[model samples]
Target: MTVGGDGGPSSPEAGPDLDAVRYLLVGYSADLLVDLDGFLPERSVAVVETPDVIEARGVRGQIGAVRCLAAVLAAPIQDEANAVRLVGLVPRPPRIGAVVPASDYGVVAAATLAAAWGLPGAGPDAAPVFRDKAELRRTAGGAGIAQPEWRLVTGPAEVAAFRAGGDGTCVLKPTNRQASVGVQILPPDADVFTAWALTAGAEEQMFRPGDAGGSRYLAERLLRGPEVSAEVLVRDGRTVFFNTTAKDVQPGRHPVETGHVVSGPVTEEVAAALATGMRALVEATKFGSGVLHGEWIVVDGVPHLVECAARLPGDYIVELIAMAYDWSLLHGFLAVLEGRAADPAPPVARGAAIRYLSAAPGTVDAVDGVEQARAVPGVCDVLVRVAPGDTVEPVTSSWKRPGHVIATAPDAPSAARAAEQARAALTIATHPGAGR
Candidate 1:
């Protein structure tokens, strides 16, 4: 971590007061930590992450009083044994009031640690279900939630069989991967072998070095409709807060998210259906107090399951939710994780949206108009991750998208327009050549 802090006493024996309320974050997330600092400014935080993540995404200097512990918690597959071993690495802080995962790969480990330490979390049983899509499908199906036809495929033959029965259009994805990695939609005439090769070969090895679920894959019949996600906060198996976020994805073989608008305009019926599906999902997972990012495809006003995550939503959705609702979602999340009651419902105070920045595949020559984009009316923030001399690859996944602009207005449409206008103000000039 670039940001330095007191590596709290080498061992628990040498630590400070035993009654201090310290939080254990199971992965390295600068944004999460910053929010934690704002929510509970006085509380101490201890983070457990692999050396690579800390090195790649350095910690910011603003988050006060953080302790960094470099440890190996990610593995080829996640299980209770690995989780237990990870817990043993913690230096036994006095009172760990809550255990939260800062990343998708850390969900199971964080839940297991929380259970072992008797802290508030999603609970051990439900965490694994949240990570594995196949298990989630079975659990959600048993709960009578609507979902597309899906099957576990061992190879191309199984995929072919699945397509043979249906219209031949199917979606293939890894059971356990984040950032839309290894997710692809195959049309009827698509080559099954080539698609399988691409899906199986995709991996987010930077933070999660190996296949978290041992190369498990799911093939599902494609559901045609708009995609939206519910940002839900649950306490003791009951949902206390819910907000629907409308999303847009790049049109191609890969379903990479390109934009998101929180509390966007939707029919009352569609909103109710999404709420119902989210409630059923919470009940099925038996998830305890925490945040759930559940996604669905609305087909004829019915919400069909896409997948869900047990941690905070990515793509700046949390920030947008806070801006739209005029409340800190991170604060509510921490409160719930600490076994406290969160506001049963928070009204939307405004509209917020985020639009990602992209460029053609080539080498970046220069990035211009970032300042002008930031100055656009209603544009809250604008960031460009690419710079001169950097390579700009095709937008195959969320990570490949360069950066984004976040905007807010009195309503969803206005906010979305503002985001787009701000995005249009900037230009990422690239050389006409294949990216490295």
Candidate 2:
């Protein structure tokens, strides 16, 4: 599958020299803060984060390692307006080179600040295009792109109208949230009150104020087919394909992604269609320079855009691509951003998969088989997130996962099998009614 643009020359004027440019990573996740060292040049990157996230997210140890740090109004998504303003408040803010949003929430802030500085990034114009689902549909739909039938709903009456005459199985979710936080597949008998309740209180606002959860939602017709994600890098309107991920999400009220397989089982035809749709999407949004994590579904040999983010994909997909390609997507992204020579083509066609470990809802008493899982053939790492005395709840979203295992093999099947074996090897003990 090829995702090529008009074959224009590299935009040498995209940004300043890599060494001369200072990167502003806008968010606070311990993993993201630490990993920036690999994608970015050390001593050239700074951060703007909320004070509480710095403490609650367990990034305290990273404070000394960062090049520089500043506090904003609140969490990245919680107070986006103030977060953008905080950039100018930082010392030597004018010297900032490029703005890199660490997550979806910081996208708007990155765009806002980047526009003010005239730096290389997704500008303020494209923020709403990617941040709001309704905007995505409007732009992509106007560009003659195919997508699932969706109805924008602000309350129960709209939900009722969409459900009364439509199929019972549909995906309804918040217009602004991610990680499947408020997404639910309503049962046929479910009513508008259920929809409101599902979308309203499902968010962890993190001290947000004033429409932080958003006032709109969408009810999308469920399309059944294999779902895949394409990571695209856009520079000066010239787009190129990065990689594809095969996703597996359970069909339920709260569908959580079970695992992912990189460069997994996708037909050549479908791949080509996905690449084309992704290029169209990038063009539609006017995303000049940035990495897009776009999801799509293949129906009857045609690719329909599902959703996308103006940032990189999370859940170790970057690491998985690195393992398969023997290259860092970050560096490739940097090359694209700076208009330098870079190739995202996979050097070796290998498969990589990651599986999460979870158990029945209860209070964690004992965990077993971490080492055993790690010892599995082709398994790379096993990370456990819970310990004894930590209460566990029924997983409703990807954030609730306790641990995960990553593995690689010659093919997707073998990789998936290895990942499953590794996760199956682990054992977590818990007691019922112990979770709060």
Predicted candidate 1 versus true structure: per-residue lDDT over 1-436, tens digit per residue: 1212233334323333323546767777766766666545354666656545544555333223443232222221244336666555555457667788888878888888787887778888899899889999999999999999999998988998998889878899999888889899888888999988988898676665544346699999999999999988888888888899999998888899999998958789888988888888878778887999999988988889999999999999999998999887787887888788876556898899999998987999989999989988899999999888888988767889999999999999899999999999999999977544
Provide backbone clash counts, one per model: 0, 0
Question: Best candidate, lDDT-wise?
Answer: 1
Where is model 1 poorest over a 10-residue stretch in terms of lDDT?
Answer: 68-77
RMSD of each: 3.9, 8.1
